[model samples]
Target chain A: MNLLPGFDDILAAAARIAPYASVTPVLRSAALDTLAGAELHFKCENLQRGGAFKFRGACNAVWSLDDGQAAHGVVTHSSGNHGNALALAAATRGIAAHVVVPEGAVRAKLAAIERAGAILHRCAPTQAAREATCAEVQRATGAELVHPYADTRVMAGQGTLALELLQQAPGLDALITPVGGGGLASGVAIAAHGIDPALDLFGAEPLGADDTAQSLARGTRVTTVVPDTICDGLRALVGERNLDALRTHRVEVITVSDTETIAAMQLLWSELKQVVEVSSATVLAAILKQPQRFAGRRVGVVLTGGNVDLQALPW
Target chain B: MNLLPGFDDILAAAARIAPYASVTPVLRSAALDTLAGAELHFKCENLQRGGAFKFRGACNAVWSLDDGQAAHGVVTHSSGNHGNALALAAATRGIAAHVVVPEGAVRAKLAAIERAGAILHRCAPTQAAREATCAEVQRATGAELVHPYADTRVMAGQGTLALELLQQAPGLDALITPVGGGGLASGVAIAAHGIDPALDLFGAEPLGADDTAQSLARGTRVTTVVPDTICDGLRALVGERNLDALRTHRVEVITVSDTETIAAMQLLWSELKQVVEVSSATVLAAILKQPQRFAGRRVGVVLTGGNVDLQALPW
Candidate 1:
């Protein structure tokens, strides 16, 4: 389960991706801060490449390969942001990319990946099927497999964001993000805690997809087949490596209802005029649902992504 | 029709409101640049106070009055951004702000103005009615009239943005914006052409409510009554003074459809992750629809505002 060797991986990723990724602004929400009784600093990863933070890892993973390995290409399976991100990173490096997307994935997302110059391959709905198909493609095409979160390189790359955040907005009382497979949350916890052990790490999860919450209580990594959350970006079950990181780091997991997430999303749009994806709303929803937990603290939340289909906004 | 005299007025206004308005970021959109076939630089006034560039003028006007006039306070007729801007500005300067808002204005906008501590003066849903009511409020309270446009101070204040834009991203091939009352567009044309005589200026108007287009073509000012357009912020006619400025400056006016505006807005949301109002989308719509004109050019567009009702995005 040791994905990263000390903090060296985080440092390496930071150096490698320095020229490519945007060091997005850490925005303070006066209205949200006043309402929540906490000073909320938003690390606006929604403004990241492919309109999501997924780009950081995707970019690093794509760029890390040696020229000989890169010539063979890279592959991943993602519903939206990751696919678009990998496609963009691959395009940036002039390398080939193969994305395994489930059938009936949002057409806009599929088109976006294609528009970014990725070769798309359709797979079955189930995770097992997706992994199998991705494996087959990787073997057949001789492309390097870059798992979205579970890979060491990807986790290392993702942790660089938290490193940047801590360096930029020091003394944050808490670091929070929406957790699906836990790559981002794990990164945040490691980076933030490594910088300062007092920094609290929290994961805002959809109540419908509360496997992480249940698994933490059960003291084991668990899987769920059917997740009924509108936050499509947060649909994955906690992987073994991420779940281990969560336990070792003692991450606090908060669950928010879909209704609350939509409410927070609507509020963000009205107040900030930034149309963030539902997953981004999860942090605000968690704070709104239980203000006492975050009240009067310097809270930092990663606006996970803005890759939601505008035509398909659930609200 | 000379409401504001040359660049002197804008310079003075800039000095007056120097401490209030935010020097918003000029963002570069790589994807949008490719789509428009131009080097696109966005003057992100969408991130300004009150979430629109209107705040600059409102803040200046509210703060520039003499001590006696400040005590008497300020009054204005606006449906949204202007009201909030004036209210916030007045509050900052320790003055009363009476806002005459037409009936059926977005509830969120009304709430925002109220939160900023403005006295609400609800009026009938018509420009004439709103103005009459605003006059009544002004007379009764002896409040200084702060017309949304058609005022010397406001125009000068609005011009400051263009001055900043020119300074920040100088040597633009052209400057474009969604023209409503023409306050912003007029100021931009003045600053852009003033700084660089060869800088081209263009105005984007909604086809459904294109009084500016007609006015420019006819060489006279025109007015519209409850004109229909998804760009709710661009329904105002080009005022007499602003029309004269546009004509004198030889600014090109282009009209775009609501469908095009929505598509442009969605494109920014998907690619740039910026939730701009429909009014701001006009510039993008214009550039996208007429790529031949913008291709290979260094173009600058004002992202005029970001205060759209996210709960009810027109898309």
Candidate 2:
């Protein structure tokens, strides 16, 4: 079993990825605040190096390797933000990155990954198929596998965002992030809870992909639910170590419907004037749905990414 | 004739509007910088209140009034960002705002104005009809008229952006802003030159509405040439005082076709991960077209707005 990343790991990761990743600005929307009835300090990871907070993790994972390990390069199985992020991260260190993309994955996302200098390996659209292909690539090139969210290094790297957010907007009463494979949420939980033991941690998940929520309720990881939402970024099953972090941190999961998420996405675009992905909208949607839980509270909302298909906007 | 605002006015306006207007962030895109062969700093006024830099001018104009004048409220003839901005600004002071909007104006824009608490008065789409309706509304309500981009206070307010930009990204070799009615360009020129007299000033104008370019070439203001472009925010004729300021500052006008602007907009959306309006993209398009002028130089590009119609995107 992989050891879950602790706050110390997150601290080390912050320093390690400092040079490779961007300290994205914390944005605010008075209009959004008024609507949510909470002070929303948006940590704009959407403007991160690879257009997502995934860069922090990918960069940290890529750079954390020893000189010998780094020479072998990095390999990841992702057809989304992680693929592009790992590719960009690898380029920063002058190393090869092999992205195992499943068939019928988003063309735009694939193009973005390729643009970031990743060697693409096509595979059948299945969890097993993707892992097999990634394994094959890793073996072929003797590259170290960088699991998107499940790996300890990636989770520790993602936790760096919480450190920056706390410093940028101190005295946050609570924090929220979109929960996909639980990489960001689990990492943020470790960092935030370590600094402020009393700070409330919340995870926003799509109703269609409520695996995290169901898992927490049952006190066991559930990987059976198939996601059916516009938030393509949040379809992954919550990783075991990530779920362990959520349980340890006492994170409360809130699930929002696709309609609510889309509406919140529109509100974000119109009010905050930021092009956040549908997946990122879950945080705001959850807040809006559970006003009583967050009213008048100072909340740090993490906008995970802004890689969207403009022509195929959900609204 | 209205007196043109100077650097001193910009300084005063910066202090005056500091409480109301946001000091928008200066964003950087390494990818875009490489593409332009220049160091680009994007002053994100699109993230400003009312989703545009128009709020800076509108806020200043509304707040510059004496108590008695303020009690009477403010009025402006605009169906765009200025109208919504003025309404929001007036609301901040607990004063009424009357917006004279043209018939057949964008329904969404008008709705935004109304949502900001401005009473909308519709008239024919002609400029004369808009001015007449505004004048009539001012007379009836005893409200002070706030010209969108012509008035001294408005220009000074817009100039605040330059002050913030210079402070945020010091040592910019050149500055560029879209020239609509010349409010932003003229104000930026005044403020930037006041700080660094040797700094180059450039204006990005749509080829379809090349009135500013034509006027600059003819050595006189040209009010003709009906606009025909996707850049709806940049169709107005340049104000006389604004033109004088532009000429006084020796501002160079760069006109780009709609195609180039739209393509640049895509690049901004993809690379910068920001939702900027088509008009704002003209600056990047201009820099890309005239690479020799900006190559290896630090250029401050102002993204003027982010109020594009989601369903009716140009792309």
Candidate 3:
């Protein structure tokens, strides 16, 4: 099996998950456009199934398995949108989903996972503990492991967003998405570039979790930085295969401070009138930070998710 | 003057404002559907140009004026979405807008009006004082008076939303909207019933400000209810012409307490992933309160606005 999804994979995934995921609306705000001095077409994945673009990848992965492999179910480790996404995706196929959630995960996220009928297994917050818990769950249930971002199927599924976006708002000069494990950015880079070779690819990274930026600069993967930003959805280390796609596409990574992200989050909420997550704000923040880079250009911004704890808003 | 808009006016308004206002998308939530046991179609006027349905009426009213009248501009006494809508509408015509705002209005709303290029005129927080200020402004500058809801032209403008909703999600068994001055409700009543006379129409009102409900029962308009709800947008007494439409169409007004409205507001924010104002929740609250009336039916709900101050969320 190919380790990285090609343009063909994205096309197939679009048809595969067409029955499940939403073709979330592309929103535009004259106010936001004026503020950034760029024509922005916001692909509102925050309104996607499970309230995030993770649903696209998770649904594709869960449904891609053969009957024999699918009967055994699926298992993964995620403490955020991915876990909630997998749980909902598995339900579509009448299969069990085992989520290995880290200890001290957000209470709201955990509750949402359980609500989707997934059996949750708690483990220490450390990466080693999370992997071990996932391994044990898989061993016991004979469920296939579906990594949130590293797998080719997941990346292809996420790439479907670019296809829909390009069709919805044609002639985009560039596209930007917040990079967590590089799943969305990598998938989008491949798909967008495949469609328009000269289109620019950009990733927004939190300054506190600038591992993607660091790895790109060093020309190799780096995972030593400890994340300390309020953008909970973007702290994961970049997946190796995911990084390869980003590197191949020459994706430019832009780092934004927490303060900037929060301020942009407020602007998005007020101007777009959409409840986007804090992580989603990074893309807008990046564009505003370097207006000269984006001025007078048509930009496609993927609002990655909207699963925020309202009571705990930073502002 | 007709004093009440008919189907023809709604069609005319639709054509007039087509160039200015957005045809806000209709959103659905399976979770909410299961919870309510009804297929709900949310007409998201919250995503409208001025972040509210008020823009439809404001835009129509502003553009409907003849060149002679348009040159002098327009004036309105409003402390909420209407002021913002009128300001924005007037800007489209390159004419001045004079807004008479009451004392102690929400600071965010005032700022939005000013940002839209309307000159603000402050008045004592009383109906008589508000009218006096508006009259004074109109006399000084031949600016035409555009009442928020009572006027026929304004009602026709608000009715345009019903035209869009019916086309977007046809075969609706019923429609519901929050009744403030009954602008949206009255206008929607005429438009919906004109399209399908058998369609049911309902008005959601705050228990603390249930003047419309009380008026309907007494066979006369009521104007003595001192508003006392968290739904700041629904505090106005129902307009005479607006009440006439409601009464003529036999609209059933359902009053909900602050507690029920707040709970429904939270559900909307979570399930719909939209930042609807507290007032917008009233329609959902009314539907959820009387499930028997709405069960197994397709209900078109008008989300009035999304102008709530995030810092002062009721929940």
lDDT of 2 by residue, B216-237 (tens): 9999989888999889899989
lDDT of 1 by residue, B65-154 (tens): 999989999999886788888998998898999999988988878988999999999988986998899889878999999888887777
> What lDDT score goes with residue B10 in model 3?
89
Task: Give me the runs in candidate 1 sitting further than 4 Å from their true place.
Answer: A224-226, B103-107, B126-128, B223-226
Superior by TM-score: candidate 1 or candidate 2: 2
Write candidate 3's Cα lDDT for A1-315 as tens digits: 339999999999999999999999999998999999999999999899999999999999998999999999999999789999999999999999999998898888899999998999999989899999999988898999999999889999999999999999999998999998898999999999889999998999999999999999999999898998989899989988889999999999999999999999998888888889999999999999988889999999999988888878898
Among incorrect, acceptable, medium and high, the docking class of model 3 is medium
The value of fnat for model 2 is: 0.53
- The alpha-carbon RMSD values of the candidates against the true structure, listed in the order shown, are 2.4, 1.7, 1.3
Q: How many steric clashes does model 1 contain?
A: 0
What do the candidate models score in CA lDDT, each in turn?
0.84, 0.92, 0.93
Output the lDDT of residue A45, model 2: 90
- What clash count goes with each model? 0, 0, 0
**Deviating ranges (above 4 Å) for candidate 2:** none
TM-score of chain A of 1: 0.96
**TM-score-sorted candidate list, best first:** 3, 2, 1
Encode model 1's per-residue lDDT on A1-315: one tens digit a residue: 246534777788889988889887777656778888998888888777778888888898988999999999999999678888899999989999999999878887788899999999998887788999999998999999888888777787788889988888888888888999888888767777778888888899999999998899899877854688988888888778888888888888999999999999987776665658998899999988888989889888888877666767777
Residue pair clashes in candidate 3: none
Which is the better candidate, 1 or 2, if ranked by lDDT? 2
